[model samples]
Target: MEDDMLTCNSVESPGPPFLDNAASSVATSLRRCANDKLPVSDNRDTTVSRWRKHCPTPIENDNIFEIETHCKDPELCSTLACDIYKHLREAEAKKRPSPDFLETTQKDIDTSMRAVLIDWLVEVSISRKKVTEEYRLVPETLYLTVSYIDRYLSSKEINRDKLQLLGIACLLIAAKYEEICPPQVEELCYITDNTYIKDEVLRMEASILGCLMFEMTAPTEKCFLRRFLHAAQLCHEGPALHLEFLASYITELSLLEYSLLCHVPSLIAASSIFLANFILKPTKNPWNTTLSYHTQYKPSTLRDCVKVLHRLFRVGLGSNLPAIREKYSQHKYKFVAKKYCRPSIPADFFQDASS
Candidate 1:
């Protein structure tokens, strides 16, 4: 299969290189960091400060070892790990695999691990929400944000304290990637409630893009379902409304714990559509028709995807998605008529939790 994507030029530099030392010693030091629960800030800051002081100016594409040391600092261990990361990244660049590989397939993640993932997403979303700016485009804006954290965690032992900063950087990157009008560096500082420095956000952004190898073709719920809905000829207004509702709800839930690596844009979008259809049109029998068409192309089963999505709604949404009805009352939403709240809903519509 010809991967047209790889042929495109995406110069994601893997920073600098590390030295060649004993792997066991490096592993031992990292183990201590994890066992002691050394604040991620301590390690991360140390590595970053080191990079700023010792790292090359105008970083070269092959200088990955220097960057790897910033990930770990034990004098000898840092050298060893940097060397390895540099070599691996070189191999990867030659082959050019997609960066969204972490969440590419559920089979790669044990069935039992899905719940843990949901919990992680929920925690990230709630924390980010407390500090994120209002009018931040779509809910899946947090999807890629969470993905950066998960991808880093899979290989490194980062303390939870730095998670928010990482989240901020990821969001900043996603905003630029997904939104027409991206937020400014100062605006992002405000969004993170001034938790991180502007320079830190900039550095983190470069690191994340590097970590993902500048590959960011992950699918969002709407992106996934739009193609499927069109091919299935389910593009009427009624279906559109339902899909919007479901996509919003599901995508929000996804922000809570779902990793962008776990599903393709199409899979995420299609799965949400299936769940929404199941919830709204229960009378429609044989839901298989909704998914049967995409089975050939996707690596996952439709039933499995739907099951995962429904589980996400139940846990991630926290009992029916902070119902706008119970909180604001139908009168505020114009008795659920979508009239006053349709084209021009009040600012508070989203400002409030129900929104």
Candidate 2:
């Protein structure tokens, strides 16, 4: 029973020629929406824009308290509830991928290629033709895999052909770090249709680890979602299982989006919960004192991220990338992807706590 992260063993090997030590910095070649802010604002780059925006605003009026209930459950590591997140909030700033990788460190690929690569990874991770139940990577693995790729790109440039190679290798790394029984290197090569031999995958893995100094335990939206979802359960409603799936679905969709880099992982997770709540229970408010207390985010701060995710929800699988949609549409996930939020939410939704 490891904490989804305490995993992974690396090898000492040279990477393929593709992870060329070249430099190319390009921004969005394909913008999904006009409001899509791809560049990470200097002020908003780190989770520590002092998390100034994430700090809770003065809500109507009630003393907010620590989430003591979760701490009571030993299985949840009640002891670390507050400290872990405090560490995560601080760590996120130091470990975040270069907010300007495309504009500085990376040059070969643009946002389009990155999007395609992410979409393909999502598809292949769950595609019947590419993987099986035993090999199926968990959501945490997928998220970390993307994190590795982005961080790698932030430091080193890669050609288009090698982009897919980088993706598979990162997937293998993340799988090992987050999976109980990670898929074998050979199986990963097979998933690539043997495009990369086992040795090539290993070489890339070693390079990625070296680049990041073997730190794959950084916080991600998935990590924050686990804790935030628990906070979400505090609703008067009894265990709304559908809310879990829906919020998870929304969070996964952000994986394909390069523009969301501006937002912190915690904010992204919070936005997912906000949108999920709205979808499942629209007549009622989405954000509440409980969520605000735990997330340290007032509804005003969530407006931008929430609107972006809400746009994604409204668009509903319009892009060629259908793996996320297909994955969530299945019965196992309660068909949360099939459920849609309206094109717009009430303006007052943002007014309750922060205005």
Candidate 3:
């Protein structure tokens, strides 16, 4: 019995202290996001600004309590859900920031490295599309990968050779966090056409985990959408299903531009839900009396998380970059591509890679 108790305690205990540095780093990122309105906005210059006008701004409502109460009836919520549709329409209006803009200003990557990274990014974009289409991966998965990669590269000097490996690792980590049951190591290896061995992938996974401090509970874009969808009472069998697809689309665009990260997930989710509602139910009375009655908050008065995400989507659409179409292409990867890849980090980012 004593041995059993000891074993249980050991099993439940948090692992080694290598996570301390990672935890501090992530904490710093989160703090920066909180402090600055434009925290992640740096990488998205020239290519992102055009979409600013295209994103929809939800109508300001004085009474959030009314919106909340009206949401109790799922049917009314579905029809009145104005956030998602507005977001999509807005997203359609703007253009994505060019890949060149990111390549130009990033401290870690020079011109040569940027060009090389773009090639790998093309592969990443394509791989993500295939995986999402085939496995029904959530848009959040791709978003998480972009977030991870962006954060990692912010301070690292990753070599062009290992870019794809970094992308793969990011995707794998995201799948484990967002998917119901992630594909096994061998399965992922197979998917990559044996470009990476199972063990190599595993090592990359460990490296990623170590970097993020294994603290994974940051609210995803989906989490926010679900909250407001439920609060607005729009989640029904038919509407809920369609709304999910729209949410995925909205989240996918946010990945290319990091500025959206500055905003709260709740705001983004709310905007997407409302916009989707509007798109699906166009003729429904825009004047939802229940909105003012149930909602305790004001849409326009609060921080503009939804508006930012919507803008990013619009920017990508305007850029007319082949990423959207190219992302869906199903091409096999080459083995040499994986073996020569290096991390996209600067030397000073981490004192110890193993940790």
lDDT of 1 by residue, 87-200 (tens): 433443333223443344222443224334444434433333434445535445555555555555454443445656666677778778777876677766765568888998
Count of backbone collisions within predicted model 3: 52
Model 2 residue 50 lDDT?
38
Candidates 2 and 3 compared: the better one by TM-score is 2
lDDT value for model 2 = 0.79
Cα deviation in Å at residue 60, candidate 2?
A: 9.2
RMSD of 3: 21.5
| Model 2: CA > 4 A from native | 1-66, 70-72, 127-133, 236-239, 352-354
* Per-residue lDDT over 14-131 for candidate 2, one digit per residue giving the tens place of the 0 to 100 score: 4433434442111232344433756544542242333434444455446443455434666766544566687898888888887678888776888878888888888767742433
lDDT of all predictions:
0.47, 0.79, 0.49
| Candidates sorted by TM-score, best first | 2, 1, 3
What are the models' TM-scores? 0.48, 0.78, 0.47
Q: What stretches of model 1 exceed 4 Å from their correct place?
A: 1-135, 138-140, 231-239, 258-265, 286-291, 294-300, 314-355
Q: Quick one: best TM-score, which candidate?
A: 2
Ranking by lDDT: 2, 3, 1
Model 2's C-alpha root-mean-square deviation from the true structure amounts to: 21.1
